[model samples]
Target: AFTVDVKSVANKQIPCHPEQKMLDAFLRRGEWIPNSCNQGTCGTCKVKVLSGTVAHPPTPDSVLSYQEQEEGFVLTCQSVPTSDVVIAVPAADKPSSTGHLLRDMTATVLQMQTTATDTLTISVGIDEPLEFSAGQYVELAIPGTNDVRQYSMANPPSQSNVLEFHIRRQPGGLATDAWIFDSLTAGDAINLTGPWGDFVYDDDDDETGMILLAGGTGLAPLKSIALHALTVNPQREIHLYHGVRRSADLYDVEFWESLARNYSGVRYVPCVSREHWSGRTGYVGDAMLADFDSCRNYSGYLCGPPAMVDAGVKAFKRKRMSARRIRREKYTPAP
Candidate 1:
C-alpha cells in the first residue's frame, strides 16, 4: 500500500492508495479521468508523473516510445506506484452522471454483416434500452473464450433499440478470433458494460464546425456522432477524413458518400496510405491539412489507433488549434 497524491489540472489535491487501479481509486473518491481503451495504447489516460516510482507491466513497444517512457508521462491504466507519489491529470470540468449509472447489460445479437475480410458490422439489441452519448464504448464478454473486449457503437442515441459496432477480427485476438470469426451468430447473447468515454460531441456548441478523423474501425463512434449530427442539425458543416491502407479496406465508403451527397454541408474525404492505385495517397492528417485551410477555427474529434490520433492532434496543434477544442478516443489494442 502506497500513498498516491493526485493533482488535478487546476492543482487540486486528491488522496488515494495504490491498492486499486488509479482510475478506480480516483472515481471512488469522486474524481474522474478521461479514458477509452483501458489498455496502454490510447494516450487518453496519460498523465504527468510529477514524482513517483511506478512499476509498469510489460507492454508492446509500439504503444509508447522510449522518449515518452523517458519523460515523466505514464498511462494510469498500466502503471502501479511503488511508493508515495504525486501526478497531474486533466481537470474534470463536468464529471459524468453516467459514472454512477455504470452497470452490466446483457444484449442479444440482432444482426451481423461482413463489411471487409476481417471486419464485421454487428448490431446488438439490449434487453433494456440504454441511454448513451455518441463516442462511447461497451465491453462485450465472449461466451466460450471467457474474454471480454471493448467496442464502440456506430449507431447514435436516436437509434435506440439497436447498437451497431464495427468489429475487426484481430489475427490472434482471443475474443474476436473466436466469437467474431467462428462462433458468434445472430440471436447469440453477450454481456456488456456501461457506455464508457467522455469524447462525445458537445451538442450545445453549434457554432463550432466539426473535423472528424478516423482510421480503420475507429470510424465506429465518429459515424455515430456524424449520423446524430445529420439527424439533429443538417446544416452543420462536417469534414470527415477516413483513412485505410487500401481502397478495399475502406468499409462503408458508399454510405459516407451518400451521406455527403444528401447533406450539402457534410464533406467526406477518403485517404489511402498505399501507393498501388490512384485516389488520395499519404497520411490522412496531411490530406486534411492540404484541403482545409481553416482547421484552427474547427473543433476536432479523433477516434483511431494512437499513432493516427497523435499525428492528427499534433497537426491541429501546429495549425494553432487549442487543446480545449479537440476531443479524442484512442483505440489501443490489448497486449
Candidate 2:
C-alpha cells in the first residue's frame, strides 16, 4: 500500500493499494476529481504529481502528451502508485457530493428498444434511488468479470430511480456485441456503479445562451442537460446540434423538434456529415460555423468522439468564444 496525498484547498492523505488506480482509490474515500471518460483518453482526470512515483500506461499523444508526462502529469484513472505520491488537484476539495454519492447497486432492466437510429435505449430500475446531476454516467459491471462499460444517463435528475441510457450499438464491442445487444434482456439484474462523471450543465452561469453539440449517440448526456436546462433555466437560449452520418442515423427528431417549437428560446438542428443533403450537411463544427457568425455571446457544450470535440472547440475559439466558456465530454470507445 502507498499513501497518496491530495492537495487543493487542504492536503489530505489516503492509502492506495498497488493494484488499484488512483481514481478508484480516491473516489472511494470521497474525493471527487473533475473527470470524464475515465479510460485515460479524455485527459480530464489528469493531475500533476508533485512528488513520488506512479505506474501508468502510455496514454495517447493527444491526451497525455510526452511533454505532459515529462512534467509529472498522469491520468489519475490510469495511474497506479508505486511509491507515496503527492498530487495537485486543481479543483477545490469536495467532500463526496451534496446529494447521494455513488455505490454498488443491483439494477434490473425494465425496458430496451431500438430507435430510428442504430442506437438502443435501455431503461433500468435500480434497487436504490441515486440522486445525480444531469449529464452524469453510470458503469455497468459485466457479470463474472472485472470489466465495466460506461454510458451516460439519458434521463434527467428527476428520474432518479429509473436510470435511462442511450447506447450506440458497436458490432465488435465487448459490452455491446457480446453482452448488451446479444444476451442482455429485460428483467435481467446487472451490477451498477454510478452516478459518476463531472460533465454536468452549469445552470447557474450568467450566460444568456448556450450551444449543445453532439455526434451520434453522444447526445446521451446532452439530452439530460437539455431536459434539465429547459426545466430549470427557462429564460436561457439553447441551440442544440446533433451530428450524424445521415438522416437515418438521427434519432429523437420529433422530441427535439417539439422542444424547439414549444420553447421560444430553443433551437435544434440535426446535421448530416456523410451525405449531400439540402439541409445542413457538414461536420458538426462546420454546421455550428454556418449558423452562428460568432459564438462570443454563448457558452458551448460539446460531447462526442475526441475528433469531433476537438473540431468543435477549434470552431468555437475561432468564433471569438473564450476557451473557458467551452466544456466537452468525449466518449471514448472501450479498449
Candidate 3:
C-alpha cells in the first residue's frame, strides 16, 4: 500500500491501496475534506497534488480542465494513488472534533411505504450508531455493482440508527425502478455510506426567521432542518412551503400540520401548480413572493429541481434577502 499525505491533517500519512480512490482512503481513516457530490461531477473535492502520482480518470472538461490537470490538480473522488503522495486539503475543511465521520453501514430495511404518487418513504435500521447533521444525506450502494445513489435523510438526526429517506421515482432509474421499487423489501439488507451534506441549520444562524421552501421530494432535508431548528428554539418563526404539481403528488402534509399544531410558530403551506385546490395554488417561488413582502431578517433554505431552486433564490433576492443566508440543494434524476 502506498502512503498518502494530507498536508492539512496532523496524521501526515495514511495507507491507500493502489486500486482505491484517494478520498475513500482518507475518509476511511477519519480524515475529511470539503465535498458535496462524491461522483466527481462537482469539483468540491478537487485538491492540489503537492507531490504525488495518481491514476486520474477521465472527468468532465467543465469540472476539471486539462490545464488544471496538468497543474497537478485532481478530483480525489476519482483519483487513485500510484505512489506516496501529498495533497493540500481546502482551507474550509477544518478538522472537527465533533463532526460526523464517513461510515460504511449495513442496514436492514425496517419499513417502506409509498408516501406520494411518485415518492417512497424508506426506513433502514443500522446496527451501529450514526451521527449526522439534520439535513445531511447518505449514499446507498447498488447490489452487485459499484454504483451508488445519494438521498437526503428525511428523519431528524436524533433518529440516528434508523435513517429515513423520501425517494422520488425516476421512471428509468436503475436504483429506483430496477432495485428499490422492483426488488427491495422489508428485512432486506443493504449497504450504505453516509452522513454527507452541508445544507443544514445551525444555532449560530438562529437570529433570523426561516423560509423553508421545497419542491416535490425535496422536502426531505428541509423537514429534518425544521424539526431540529424547533428543537433548538421552538419559538423560532418558520414558514415551510411544499410545492407539487397536484395535491396527489404531495405527501407528509399531515406531518407538517402536526408540527404546526404543536409548535405555534410553524406554518405549513401546501402549493399545487397544475391543479386547482382550496389551498395555495402556484409555483413555490411565487407563493413565497406573495407571502412575504420583505425577507429582511429571514434565511431561505430551498431544495428541488434546479429550476425551482434557482427561481426560489431569485424570489428570495427580490424580497431583499442576502445571498449568504440562502442555502439550497438541487436534485438531478439519475441517468
Candidate 4:
C-alpha cells in the first residue's frame, strides 16, 4: 500500500493500494475529486503531483499531453500511486464534511421506444421521486445480475417520478444484451441510484450565455440542462450544438427545431459527419467556431465521447474561452 497526502484538504492522508486507482482511494475515504468518466478520458480528475511518481494506465493522448505528464500532472482516475506521494487537488474538488446524499430507489419501466435506429429511450416511474440537479446521471442495475450501468437523465427534474434516459445500444454489451435489448420491459422493476455528476447548470449565472455541446446520446444530460435553463430563465441566451455521425441519428430534431422557431433566446444547430447532409457537416465544433468569434462572454457545457469533447475543448480554447467557465463530461464504455 502507498500513502497519498492530499495537500488541499487540510493535508489529509489516504492509503492506496498499487492495484487500485487513486480516484477510488479518494472516493473510498469520502474525498471528492472532480471526475466524469472513471476510465480517464474526461481529464476532470487531473491533479498536480507535488512529490511522487504514479503508474498510470494507457491514457488517450488527447486527455493528457506529454508535457503535462512530465510536469507531474496525473489523472487520478487512471493512475495508481507507485510510491508514497503528495498531491494537490483543486479547491473546487474538495468534498464537504457531509458528502452528497445518494439514494437507492425502485423504478418500474414505463415505456421503451426506439428514438433512432441505434438509440433507445426508456422512461421509468419511481415509487418515490428523486430530487436531483440538472445534468446528473443514475446507475441502473440489471435484474438478477451484478451488472450496473450509468446513464444520464434526459428529462429535467420537473418530471418528478418520471425519469427518462437515452441509451445508444452497443451490440453484445453485457447490460444491453441481458436487459436493455430484450429482458427488460414495461412494468419491470429495476434498481436505480444517483443523480450524481458535477456537470450541472448554474442558475446564478444569468448574465453569461450558455453554449451546450453534445454528441450522440450524450445529449441526455445536455437536454436536461437546456430545458431547465429555459424554464428557469426563458430570456437566457442558450445555444445547443448536437452532433451525430449520420442524419438518421438526429433524434429530437423536431423538438429543437420548434424551440428555435418559437424561442428567440434559443438556437439549435445540428451537425452531421460521415455523410452528405444538407445541414452543417464536418464537426459540431466547426459550427460552434463559425457561430462565434470569441467565447469570452459565454459559459460552456460539453458532454460526449472523449474525442468529441476534447475537440470541442480545443476549439473553444482557440476562441479564448476561459477554462474556468467550461464544464464537461466524457462518456466511455462501462468498466
lDDT of 3 by residue, 244-266 (tens): 99989999989999999999999
Tens-digit lDDT track for model 4 on 107-222?
Answer: 99999998887788899999778777788888888777866798999898888799999988887788876569867789888898675567777665667899999999999999
Which candidate should be chosen as best, given TM-score against the real structure?
A: 3
lDDT of each: 0.78, 0.84, 0.86, 0.83
User: In candidate 3, which residue pairs clash?
Assistant: none
RMSD of each predicted structure = 5.1, 3.0, 2.1, 5.0
Off by over 4 Å in 2: 9-11, 50-53, 58-62, 65-72, 82-84, 90-100, 276-279
- Over the stretch 99-118, how does candidate 2's per-residue lDDT look in tens digits? 33657789999999887565
* lDDT score for residue 236 of model 2: 61
Distance from true location, Cα of 80 in model 4, Å: 15
Local error of candidate 1 at residue 172 (angstroms): 1.9
Clashes of each: 0, 0, 0, 0
Clashing pairs in 4: none
| Model 3 stretches astray by more than 4 angstroms | 9-11, 65-67, 93-98
* Prediction 4 TM-score vs. true: 0.77
Single out the weakest 10-residue window by summed lDDT for candidate 3. 90-99
In candidate 4, how many Å is residue 178 off?
A: 3.1
- Residue 95 error for model 1, in Å? 6.8
